[model samples]
Target: MNDYKATVAVIGLGGIGGVAAASLCHGGCHEVVACGRRPLDRLRLERPEGEVEVPIRTLTDPQDASPVDWVLLVTKAQDTASAAPWLERLCGPATRVAVMQNGIDHAARVKPFIGEAIVVPTIVYYNGERIAPDHVRIRHIGDNDMLAPDTEDGRAFAALFENVPISVGLSADFTTLAWRKLMINVVVNPITALTRLRQGVLQHTDIRNLTRQILDEAVAVARADGADLKDDEAERMAQFIGGFPEDAGSSMYFDTLAGRPLESRALTGALVEIGSRHGIPTPVNTSLLALTNAVSDANG
Candidate 1:
């Protein structure tokens, strides 16, 4: 039933990219290419209902890849450079690159690699865990698994998932929504990674107060960046953070435990950068950024 309607190349087959590739293949609406550091013959997708095993075509070498209609750049912000080879091969003038990672500067991170291609900044709310290199688990975290700007390409990106279980939404004010998402990341990633704990740490009263401080400063930065956030945005975000599952571990926590460089530079670190640009004082995030950097440097 697959007519190869479109060519979709997914680079960085971690939790997010892996599950996305499997979903697209299961949907059978496009010709999906799973590009990674090594060749893989099959992918196991664990869902709430059951597990699915999909036979997939994976390209471990960049030279074998060609321009595709869509490139889902799912690499961590810090590893964007490592994925340059794959982006160069899979991106063309007609390509639309959907960056499905943390941080706000999605286009700036991936633009240089994709020549004349459109950069689609995306917000992913789904929780995905890479249990193994070939095995991945996905849990939808919100009403929508993904969100894109309400543009023609964003609509098309959403349509690509209409036939699949994962839901994609289009937003007119994607920037504001993106900042909202970043507001969450700035709290969870740093707290979890620094404490070497999971989301449970955020439940502590002291930690909750700390979360407020971080958000107050970060929210100021977000509003300065024109995100339409209110003065009480920090309070709103704290309530939202309280809703996360305690057992859930953040991406940075996992990276810290694995002795890999944390994505702090993108999450908390990005907040600091934006805050500085706006001449706003992000003392809380700035300190966290330094701690996270030390942790990341020790890992590297």
Candidate 2:
């Protein structure tokens, strides 16, 4: 086991952040600090087995946040700017910031605040929902791992999750993994949001075909970006989504239905932009991005 004791601060106590903070605290390796828009005492977490009242220090303002060895950002990509102040306050010389949100542009997003500190890009896979102001329902305890490129700080961050159920591994080709996840997101998220349906609803023949098209476009974009993704990867992703519970709703779908701001730019929009840069046509993704943006604007 690695012998490193570092303070951890998790910004944005949403589904992913709250669970990560609790897991880190439960591991007894690091001092986990939970920070959010509201005060920490006001937060609560609802798990499948029972409700957990987090005891860590909670701060509503970034200025009130204490410096730590690592900062995990779990907020929506669009909310990165709002969390900047907290990031600045929580980061020290040796601190490392991990972006646990969606999308492939993790490093680029936080480069402004953390110039020297390691900005680790991580892809989180867990099915969780915020049931209340301080309560989150963890639907699935799927692999809670993070893949980082080979680096000293990346190795250190991986060691932190070693004892815990969360797996952290080093990936020489991190971009491919990220793009693969993005393709999976592209296939399932928009359709679920548009239809107000769950994962299993896409099992219909027509819906499945549409999902395949989206995945194909995303795969093309990934290839153009120098990420080697197989043609059948899209079908495999669709099959994975088909295996989920019939009533399971993705975070993107939930956000769309609730009239909250969606991660349009981070999800489908990013694919379209990258595809254009490589002169690769991504009509399906481009169309979906446009539609989602329109829906978000209409809802707003």
Candidate 3:
């Protein structure tokens, strides 16, 4: 297993980070370094297939870290600032950094600390949760897919996950890709968080109509922002979400329940911000953004 040569630092070992660390370790092709605020000797990932234990060099302090071949910034968008110290130490001139968080314009978000490193924007499609320290529960049985821009660095980033179960591929149009994922997040996250319900709420006729309006608003904003989204994208997403598992919940819902700060700013807030900049109205998303922020403030 030690034969795999590349060194990877997975920052913020939460659900997404845990899944990435586990899959990469399962690939058996790279040395993984788990970075977080707490110390952990190992990471336990519980998938439907079976349980996987990945032993990693966990570091609590940025001082103990050094430059790696790849740095996976898996923190929430709102916490980008907090991960600055880790990025400062883990990135070098040639290091390829992947921003594995939600929202668009990922490269610009981390550009401040990454300096000359190649920044790859990654969009992850999977469901997982960190149930305890060093332990995570894979919420879905489907394959975890990661989509990156079709470029030299993007392909190289995808190569790091070779032999892993997750699907790592490149997209010719990353703008549409990011907007597509954002459409899903904006639709389901706020509703689930506000109603304290899971994705099952979308099954209701009234809720489905509301979801459509939200998606429509977000799609409009995305189009104005230069994404090539289709007219029927909202309709298609509403149908898909309606058929989702009754107990399926979004990260926002989980964060609200856990009393953790919400990433509303990254999800809906981003939509609203860009919509304003482009002179496009995002009334539905703006309202959701306010409600989600209120929930976060309450929790705080």
The candidate maximizing lDDT is 1
lDDT string, candidate 1, 194-245, tens digits? 8999999999999999999999988888889889887778898899899888
Residue pairs with colliding backbones in model 1 are none
- The positional error of residue 276 in candidate 3, measured at the CA in angstroms, is 1.3
lDDT of 1: 0.90
| lDDT (Cα, 0-100) at 221 in candidate 1 | 89
- Worst lDDT run of 10 residues, candidate 1, spans 1-10
Which residue ranges in model 2 land beyond 4 Å of their true spot? 42-52, 139-144
**Model 1 root-mean-square deviation:** 1.6
Give the distance in Å from residue 273's predicted Cα in candidate 1 to where it truly belongs.
1.1
lDDT of 2 at 257: 85
lDDT at 21, model 3: 88
Against the hidden reference, what TM-scores do the models get?
A: 0.97, 0.90, 0.94
Sorted by lDDT (best first), the order is: 1, 3, 2
Candidate with maximal TM-score: 1
Write candidate 3's Cα lDDT for 1-300 as tens digits.
224478999998888898888778777788888999988887888887799887767899999999999999999888998999999999999999999999886887899988898899999887668888789876544344788889998888878877777777688998988998898888888999999899888788899889988988888889998898788888887787778789888888888888988989888888999899999898888888999999988886
Please write out the lDDT profile of model 2 over residues 1-300, one tens digit for every residue: 867888888888788887777667667788777887776553465655566665667777776776788999899988898888888888877789989888988888888876577788887866656766567655444554567766776787788787665667787788898898898787778888878788877888898888888887888889888887887877787787667677777877898888987788888988988889999898888888888888877776
